[model samples]
Target: MQIRLAGGRIAAEVHGSGEPLLLFHSLLADRSSFDRITGQLAESFQVIVPDLPGFGASEAVTGGLEPIADRMAEAVRDLKGSHRPIVLGNGFGAFVALQMVIRHPGLVSRLVLADCGACFSEQGREAFRTMAAVSSAKGLSALSETAMRRLFAPDFQAAHPELMQERLAAFLRTDPAVFRAACEALAGLDLRPDLTKVDVPVLVLVGEQDEATPPAMSRELAAGLPDARLMILPGCAHVPQLQAPEHFLEATLTFLTNDDTGRDSERVQAVA
Candidate 1:
């Protein structure tokens, strides 16, 4: 489950069989956030989920963005062999996925950008800056509860205390320094200029209740892509896969299968 990269070891888990699909977790999350959806996805595709550098069991990165992108692309390449694979990322993970498409176009056959937005703008930069500052001053524990609440609708959280606690625990498991680094990376990211360079088919999924990135931002990202589709999931928050597993799975499977309509009969009904 661990591969030695140039500067560190990348902890990645592989499951199922068939076409390869790579998963990237959100800013404060690791591969385990997708645990509820992975089993179902693995039934049809080979799901490769990695705990990004500085998060979970993955080693920290000594270099910056360029090296980070190269390392992630390399990880994907190692997982998929010669054939380009579908790359999917949620939240911060989506940002990295977009970078992969732009920085290593030939390595990705398709993209699934969930709960992320256009980072090529002042507002996007500001969000990252805010996260960086907060992480540096307050640490991951201070932001854990708020982060969880922000990822879901008001009623959703009230109904899912156990789920929120589980996720918050994961987010808090990382070292404070590592969390701060992630925030700084987010603040420094702005890939608007490179969006046009991405030629692969893309699917952008947004949560209707997502205030962090908002739905409009996701729309803008979809508009910038060459061949892309946008789907807004109702009654969901920042982490739709965790907030509404069935809808998230439908949107994801539809995108991966090349269904332009964003509709799939098969749905993951329950969370793991």
Candidate 2:
């Protein structure tokens, strides 16, 4: 489905038949990033997965995170009506989700952020800038290796060569200009101070072996948010949903259902 927003048309995949749950993809991925978990999530909630503008089938529009969030928030408001949906964002999408909360309070019922932090370290920011430069000058192919390293853990890549190839193919299809723009935008992001404004129940999930955002980044994000908890998936990398889908789903379901009494669960566990 394509929804026309103020900025441009947003390409989305809608499934299931309950309350809305928006799934936002990472920088290197499209809506398909959540394909593994969508069925399970859709069983209990309506899953709305959209390609952020400039990726997938969405119209490519150049702007920073604020504009992107505004457009996405408008589209969500139109689709879900008065129903406040739970939002789940991964990597770059997580950054946009935080912006949505900050820019439009009460727009979301709950928040789930995966593999993203409040702000990147100086070194990380520099890395993003380098990615942008490389993509702009030589295209996505030039940065494929770097992207893979940031996206998946070494062990997972070594074990799942076919999966890695699949993702690489998808990465090659991304618009280099748009990819560079996103990287530049991310390099300037710092959402630490605004995290306090998020009042909804928030769940922060990160892979223990995640290299791009790291576990420390998630710890900072959880600590900064007013009502938030952090869960670390063992033996996983930047994309835990892909690296450890079962564990990811269990922790997510538990958090969304509010079955656990404790506000924080540092580790992912199977839900009985």
Candidate 3:
């Protein structure tokens, strides 16, 4: 489904029933990135997955993360009324989710941040700048290999050649300008100081082998947030949901359904 928000059209996929649960995909990725775990999540909550503006079928919108968050909040209100739904965001989307909570407090009931951190390290920022420059100069094809390396662990990439090619094709199809824009947006992101402001329960999940954000960043995020717990998925990389769907679902569902004070008690079993 597509909804007119602000000045642009936002494309989204809505499924199942019950309380609303919004899923936000990563940079260079569309809503289909969450296809692996959508069915399981939908069984218990209404799943609303949308393509970030400039990424998929969603029309591009102006401004950075703040304006995007505002538009997303508006879309949520329009779709579910006064309902404050649970939000799950990965990679760039996680940054947007954090922006949403900070910009519009009480907009999200609970938060699940996956493969994201409070802020990028200096080296990470440099990498993003390089990505933007490369994409702008050489186009999306030039970014395919680097993007895959940053997204999946070496073992997974080696084992799943078919899936790797599939993702590469998708990445190649993305508009280089949009990819560069996203890289620039990420280069400017810094949410460390604002972490203390987040009062809602949060679940921070990261792949143990994640190279993009890294586990150390996730640790800082968990420590900074007022009420947050960290869970590391073994042998997984940037996109745990894609690389380890069962473990991802178990960790996320357990956290979302748990009534406990969002502590470490609800552990997501590490896959062997």
Candidate 4:
């Protein structure tokens, strides 16, 4: 389905019916990235996956990243109406999700951030800049196997050749200009200063072998949030949802269902 946002058209696919879960995919990926997990998640929650502007079926963002975030938040609000939705983001999509929480707090009830940074550290900014430059210069074809290798564990990529091919195709299809602009916006974003304001429950999931954002950075993101849980998926890389679907599904289901009970389990206790 398509919806008009602040400045562009949004193409989104929604599945199941229950509490709404808006999923945002990382750079170069669209709603399709969540195809495998969506059926599982949709069984419990209404999953709304949108092809972010300039990346998927959505229209280009004429204003830039911040506007893109705002537009996304608005689209969610407009699409779901009064329903309070759980927001989940992957990689660069996680960054936008955080931005949504920061700029449109009322729109997001809880956050599920996987394989992404919180944008509070210099290293994170620098890393984003590097990705943008590389993508712009050589398009997705130029992405070194070294980068792909880091994004997924050797075992997972080897086992899922078709999945890897689909991901690579998405990367190559991304427009260089849009990719560069998004990266520049990410480079300037810093959400750390406002972390305390985010009092909602947060679940942070990181792949053990994820070099793009790293586990330590995810730890920092969890640390800054009010009530947050961090889960490390074993033998996985940046895209755990794709790399470690079983673990990802288990952790995400538990979090969404509020079934976690132990120290690391789901806890609804508010920070404030």
Candidate 5:
């Protein structure tokens, strides 16, 4: 259903009870990306997953990533109310969540930053530029395969053909304008200096085989934060939660519930 935010209405799914857990999906993917795990998550917390600013039923907004982040932050304020929620962001959504935390420090209690970094390498920025240009000129259908490759590893895609088809459908549903704007914003984004503002604990999780935001990027993000832990899911790619739901849950469940005391143990696996 549509949830009203300070800026606009957004499509969202809410489940279970306990503390709130907000999920932000990747640019190429929609909220449905979390379907495989939301049920189990709902068993422990009130999991709220939205289509982001422009990906699904939510209306699109202009003026770059700041507005996108602002809108999402508004969603946080509206849903969270008196409770400081736990936020989990994947890929582009991670960037949005980071900006949200930077702009509003006390809005959330903790963050599960997955497959995102403070800034991209030049080569990474160039990749987004090339994608935006191609998708703009030739359209998303032309970039479908490339987009899927960025989401899942090639072997994984080959192994899960039906799931790949479903994901492709989700990607094609994205608005061209929003896609280009997001790509451009991500290419120019730099959130390093603001990382210090996030006083809440963070779990910087990444897929070992992820090329989109590489493990190195997660390392940089973990190093920049005030209080954080880094965890790497073995043999997974960008959307590990979809590809390896077990590992994703194992790595994040404790942190999401705020029961993570084993900072040095491999309770949810280690980063090295």
Candidate 6:
């Protein structure tokens, strides 16, 4: 259900009842991308999965990720209950979450960021630019193969034909304009200078084989942020949760439930 209190710019489904846990999906995927793990997470959290702006039932926003983050903040405010939300973002959603906490200090209690970083290297930036140009000219279908490659390792794709097909369908459903805009936003984005402003506990996870954002980017993201922990999911690519759901859950749950470490848990440079 859309948050009636928030005027419904963001389309979301509510699950269970407890501390709010917002799940933000990747650019190559939609809200349904999280379907595999939402139920188990719901057992412990009131999981609210939203279709980020320009995806699914959600309304599109302008000005790239900034406004999208702003819109997401509104969703947080509307859905927040007794506790501040613990946000879990994947891929592009991770980028939006980074900006949201940066732009709005003390908003979420903590963050679980997967497959994202503060900035992309030249080669990475070029990938986005190339994708944007191709998708804008020939439409999203033209880049289906490339998008799948980024999301999963070639071996994984070859092994999981049905899942690959499903992911491809989801990728094609992305609006061409929105897809292009996000690609452009990510290509030029550099949040390294402002990383200090995040000021919240963040658990950063990247796939060992991620080609889109790469592990190096995740390393930089963890290093730049004030308090963060990094984990590399074995045998996974861009979307670690999708590729290795058990590993993803174990890391995320441990981080979310273990608060005894205090400031140390948030240390960005630590890797396990």
The most accurate candidate by TM-score is: 6
lDDT for each residue of candidate 3 in 7-33, tens digit (9 for 90 to 100): 446778888888889998888566788
The per-residue C-alpha lDDT of model 2 at residue 165 equals 92
Q: Each candidate's lDDT (Cα)?
A: 0.76, 0.84, 0.83, 0.76, 0.87, 0.87
Candidate 5, residue 172: how far the Cα is off, in Å: 0.6
Q: Give one digit per residue, the lDDT tens place, for model 5 in 1-272.
A: 33555455677878887788989999989999999899999999888998888877788889998888888888888874567988999999999999999988899988999999999999999999999999989999999988989999999999999999999999999999999999999999999989889878889899988999998898888888887888888888899889989888987886766665334422235533
Q: Provide the TM-score for each candidate, comma-separated.
A: 0.88, 0.93, 0.93, 0.87, 0.94, 0.95
Give each prediction's root-mean-square deviation over alpha carbons. Answer: 4.4, 2.3, 2.2, 4.2, 2.3, 2.1
Could you give candidate 4's per-residue lDDT for residues 20-41 as a string of tens digits?
8888998756667788799989
Query: Candidate 2, which segments miss by more than 4 Å at Cα?
Result: 1-8, 259-272
Candidate 1 residue-wise lDDT, 23-98, digit = tens: 8988766688898899999999888888777777677775555666677887876663656788889987888788
Model 3: lDDT equals 0.83
Worst 10 residues of 3 by lDDT: 263-272
Error of 1 at 267 (Å): 22
Deviation from truth (RMSD, Å), model 6 = 2.1
Clash number for model 1? 0
Comparing 2 and 3 on lDDT, the stronger one: 2
Q: For model 2, which pairs clash? A: none
Q: By lDDT, who's the top model here?
A: 6
Poorest 10 consecutive residues by lDDT, candidate 1 = 263-272
**Candidate 6 lDDT score relative to the true structure:** 0.87
Clashing pairs in 1: none
